[model samples]
Target: MTYRLPSLNSLRAFEAAARHLSFKTAASELGVTAGAVSQQVKKLEGSLGVTLFRRLPNGLLLTPQGEAYLPPVTKVFEDLTEATEAIAPAINSRKFRVGMSRTVKQMLPANWPDHDVGLRNHIRDRIET
Candidate 1:
């Protein structure tokens, strides 16, 4: 059945942006650009006819509606993640996985884990995207 609701992408953008109170942080976590996050949040606000944030020159502050909305949205995402993991145990296994962004990786020393050969012994594989 078709449902009338905001797009999932917009909802995800709002949830991440509101949680961090920064489009840039949300974008980093979501693997998108800060501008994309801002646009999605803006489009969501327009569709909902609600002002969700007060954009200050320094940072963001949630409007009363946004404060009210964040909890349920966060809960839904948590539940979705939990359910997905439950059905796909390998995805949530005990295997050690390192997920890092280029910006974050650059913050570390150039030789990082490589400098410590012992670290590589435990890692069966390394994948970069």
Candidate 2:
């Protein structure tokens, strides 16, 4: 079945902010800036046409809509985690090997010009000595 949804990032931001009840705390947990989390939550709210939180002087309070929205969104993420974990080993173990043509390898320079010498000069000098 197809699911019409807001952006994953927006959803993630909303979920984190809801759990923490503070955009700054959520931002810290998500490794982003507080403004980024707030913007994402705003984007999610716009897409849903609902205000998810009441912004207060000190912190945030969840609106009724946000209270209703959180559980299902959290469930979706949990399901996603379970599915990814089930497939993780195969995903992790798969190797991507790249082959370059001899001509392409030859075309690439191994070292910069003489004026850019540092460790390269030391190595070359040692080799020459």
Task: Give per-candidate clash totals.
Answer: 0, 0
lDDT of 1: 0.91
Highest TM-score against the true fold, candidate: 1
**Residue 34, candidate 2: how far off, in angstroms?**
0.3
Could you tell me every candidate's TM-score relative to the true structure?
0.75, 0.67
Count clashing pairs, candidate 2: 0
The pairs that clash in candidate 1 are none
Report the lDDT tens digits of candidate 2 across residue range 55-92.
99999999999999999999999899789979885654
CA RMSD per model (angstroms): 5.2, 12.5
Off by over 4 Å in 2: 89-129
Model 1 misplaced stretches (Cα beyond 4 Å): 93-122, 126-129
Per-model CA lDDT versus the true structure? 0.91, 0.85
